[model samples]
Target: MFLILFFFTGFTIIAFISFLDDIYSLPSRYRLIFQFCGILLLLCQVYYSSPYSYWLFFFLSILSVGIVNAYNFMDGINGITGIYSLILIICLSYVNNFITTFIEEDFIITIILSVSVFLFFNFRKKAICFGGDVGSVGIAFLLVFFTGQLINTTYDWKYLFFFSIYGLDTIYTILFRLSKKQNIFEAHKLHFFQILVYQTGFSHLQVAAGYAISQLLLNIWIINYSASNPLFYLPILFLLVIMHFIRKKQGLAITIK
Candidate 1:
């Protein structure tokens, strides 16, 4: 409980600072510095003696920072971060139920519900506020922590595959941009979600709703499959393709943006 509180405090601090930074127009370099500090602090608290070695721990620390930033990048539209956060939390919840080891359901459930409440307000049209970079970093930190714990105990390397949607989209989009000689890290409205909103004229809420529902259904199917099955994953790919077309027809493909 104390450590969970620490997570909230750390992220909330980041979010608060980000709020100021957003309003005051702080230097991008300063904000990056703060984000790196927060990540280092969070990493310091995470010690793993479970099943992995120092090398894995070191790798995860670096990966968590990258993921934290990647999520911040994806925060180009409303509901994207919150929706993704909620999906991951729910996935962790289901993961808690089926897996015998490293149960942290209470903390994970609390975080999910808390974020869901936050999303209800933020994911709306003409939102009160965008979830600034701090919101992005904070949630990413939480997910990384949980993910590490899950992989540590379950020893399931394939669990990472569950993040395929976000993983593939962000990575591919970056590569595509780079191939075209574009700055991969810079802010641009080229992501799938952004394209969907701008080109399709789809209501922001509707697009977010689509992603949320799709993620919900996908996670449900994965949970039903009981980690033993690899074959079920193929069908998920088909669904991904179908969803892409639906968005494309609706003028929502991320690539089009």
Candidate 2:
């Protein structure tokens, strides 16, 4: 009961501030500060419940913050946020039902339903609305909380594969920006999905559906075969190489322009 309260309270703080940012254009620093505070509150519940090592706590804190920001950064197009989040949440729901049962089934269902509603409006060729920072950040925080709990319960880090797609895109974009001497913190449309939409002439729905499908396939593999082999990351590595080639080809095109 207390854990649920902690989770919701922390989520409320992050979501409320994110909502404000959507409306008021709050400074980045203030958003970051509150984000950390919110994550800290969620982690506090974990700390008191199981008392893991300080190192683990520190790592989870950093990871949680990164994921929250990554999720927010990835929310740049129609249907991508709603679609990707719905797929990921559905994957988590599978884990809850068949794997480890860390969170409530009803809780996951409610989220699925909410994302479905958002998709009805946002998944069209001309989106009626967007997830915005509040929607993206809120769902990201909730997933982080759920993922953290599952990892804690099972003591398996492989579950992180659930976030592989977004994590890959975020890391690659940051590195690509750094190589060009650009500030990664600034807003730009360098993400692979963005590139597909703006540069490759793909429709927003097409790009969004591509991402969701890729993640769905990846999640299926992770849930089935990853536990048996250590080389599960080979596919992820292959994906990285593909992304590199695409970006390289596109990077040259941008240069020629």
Candidate 3:
């Protein structure tokens, strides 16, 4: 009971500030402070119940902040967040049911249904509603919590593959920006999906579907083979390398104002 209270309280804190940022365009530092506070609350819960090593907790803190911001950064187009998150939740549901029961099945179902509803409105060329920072960061935090639970239950780091698609895109984009001596925090259309949409003439739905499908395929592989053999990551790595090459080919000369 106390665990649930702490978790929800932290989520509320993050979501409330994120929603305010959506409406008022709050400063990034203010948002980060609240985000850190919320994540700290979550870490306290972890500490009280099934604590890990200090280094692991430290790494999770950094990763949590990065994922929350990455989810916000990647929410640039219609249906991407809605579709991607829906697929991810479904995959996580499968893990919860079949692989390892770390979290409640009902909770995953609720999130799955919620994302489905969001997709109904947003998964179109002309979206009726945008996720904004609130929707994106809130869902990201939930995902981090759930994924953390699963990892802690099974003690397998391979679960991190669940976030591979977004992580790859976010990390590669940051490196690309750094190579050009650009401010990594500044908004730009250099993300692989963004380049596909703005530069390659793919429709928004098309790019969104492609990303979701790619992640789904990767998840399938991870669930089936990656668990038994670590070498399975080779194919996944090869695929990501190909994606990076394609993004570079398309985005190298593009400039944003």
Angstrom error at residue 75, model 2 = 0.5
Compute the lDDT of residue 40 as modeled in candidate 2. Answer: 88
How many Å off is the CA of 27 in candidate 2?
Answer: 1.7
lDDT for model 1 comes to: 0.68
Worst 10 residues of 2 by lDDT: 248-257
lDDT of 1 by residue, 1-257 (tens): 55555555656656666777767967767766666666555544544235557787667656666677677767777787888788878877877887544655788878988898888788877787666766776777778767766766767655665555666567656765776677675667766677667876777778777766776777677656656776768756776676467545754333342
Q: What are the per-residue Cα lDDT tens digits for candidate 3 across 17-75? A: 99999999998999999998888777767555665778977778888899889989888
Better of 1 and 2 by lDDT: 2
Clashes of 1: 2
Stretches of candidate 3 above 4 Å error? 226-230
- The order by descending TM-score is 3, 2, 1
Which regions in candidate 2 have their CA more than 4 angstroms from the true location? 252-257
What are the models' TM-scores?
Answer: 0.76, 0.94, 0.94
> What tens digits encode model 2's per-residue C-alpha lDDT throughout 1-257?
87768877898999999999999989989998999889989988756667578898888888999999999999988899889989989999999999888878998999999999999999999898887899999999988887887877887777888888899999998887887778777778888888888877899999899989999988888877756597777778988998889888776334211
Best by lDDT: 2
